[model samples]
Target: MKRKGKRKMLIAIIILLVVVVVGLGGALFFTAGERREARNLPIGHVNFKQLHDGTYLGKYEGGMYKWRANKVQVTVSSSKVTDIKLIEHTEKQPTGITDELFSRVIQSQSLQVDTISGATLTSKAYLKAIEEALEVAQE
Candidate 1:
């Protein structure tokens, strides 16, 4: 009787662990899929003239669960970034923090912005996605 009780408890523990693992995995899958989708989106091939003489819109996304989206519609002239506009800022994870960090990225086209200290991964992911978006819009 004692042996049976221990086996049942062990099985229950294993099942619970599996459920948690599966749930976390699903969240990651969705997050990654969203990011990949952004990369594939067609921006209509921004002409060099448009990039330098007109404006274009672009977007970025990064999050594990309850993602924070970033978008910047920028204007470039003479190979220099002139103005940037935020389309939708869904920074659901860290409130207003990511926006501030994004501001830093704009000031200097480097993710070495502020680091965000603890949310390092989130910051890097956001920056990378933005870089990808910029690459698309410029190309």
Candidate 2:
């Protein structure tokens, strides 16, 4: 009787552990999917030409679970994007990813550039920051 009781308890504990592990895994998967969806959302365009020729500070916090740029400085000169500086960011990717995105923005003088393939969330956040900064320039 004692042996049977111990076995039953052990089985119950194992089942509970499995349920907890599966639940946590499901939660993580759902959160990751939500973040991916947020990353894929449209990055609004900003017409650099409409912005004044000056430096502007922009900041954007991505949706829950997404990467974010806490602060960005966008410099506009002669109705063009002259520089993009990431002042603060929460991206874990290397700096090269940021540089590539900044280069695209400067080259196109617009926010409608393609996102970095592997760092889509960071790219979107950077673009959103630039757009917000340009919006400030317009005011």
Candidate 3:
């Protein structure tokens, strides 16, 4: 009787472990897909010359899982991107992308600026939002 009880307990523990492992694997797979989609997001060209002086709001609806969703307020002055403010983000922690990175966009007068290291996906999402705001300024 004692041996049977031990065997049942061991089996239950094994099943719980398997369930946990499978759940983790599924979550990882989903996250990997989301990251891949974000990494491949296209950053289109924004013509500063066409943008009128104005403040515009833009948003990225996030990719597959909406994990990186963000919004920005972009200011265009004299047909140039004068400033970019991060209004909101879904990231769990700050990704070190801030004024300096936005400064690059303003300085370049383009959305093709280099992304922040180790924050490529977040950078792209923000850039895309910026591009959208610029597009609105164009109209």
Candidate 4:
């Protein structure tokens, strides 16, 4: 009788562990899917000529779970993207990414620039925010 009881308890513990592991795995899979989706988000072509001269604020709500959400203040002057300021971001220090990416955008005067290596998703999110700010400037 004692052996049977112990066996039953052991089986229950094993089942519980399996269920926990499976649940955690499923959650991670879904979250990863969303993260990947954010990376693939399309960046639209922005015509600098159409943008008005002003500072506009914009934001990308990141992915489904907002892990990469960010905001930017884009300055347009003389029909050019003069500057891009990182107002808010998820990174502890996004200076490097923003410096490189924003300079590329300013130099090109477009949002179709290549994303920074190793920070593709972050680049896209920031670009999206800049796009939004430009869209507002156009209006």
- Between candidates 1 and 4, the lDDT winner: 4
Off by over 4 Å in 3: 1-24, 93-95
Model 4: per-residue lDDT, tens digit, 32-116?
8877788679998777889899899999998888878899999889988898999888766458878999999999888999999
Best by lDDT: 4
Candidate 1 lDDT over 16-123, as tens digits, reads 999999999998886776566544443222233333345666655544433546665665567655555555666554645566766776566443455577665555
Order of models, best TM-score first? 3, 4, 2, 1
Top model by TM-score, which number? 3
lDDT of 1: 0.58
Q: Which should have the higher TM-score, number 1 or number 3? A: 3
Query: 22-97, model 2: which lDDT tens digit per residue?
Result: 9999988878875776667676766556888889999887667545646899888887789989898776778899
Q: Where does the lowest 10-residue lDDT sum fall in candidate 3?
A: 91-100
lDDT of all the models against the reference?
0.58, 0.82, 0.87, 0.89
- Candidates in order, TM-scores: namely 0.44, 0.75, 0.79, 0.77
Model 3: per-residue Cα lDDT over 69-89, one tens digit each? 989999888878888999998
Model 1, residue 102: C-alpha shift (Å): 3.4
Clashing pairs in 3: none
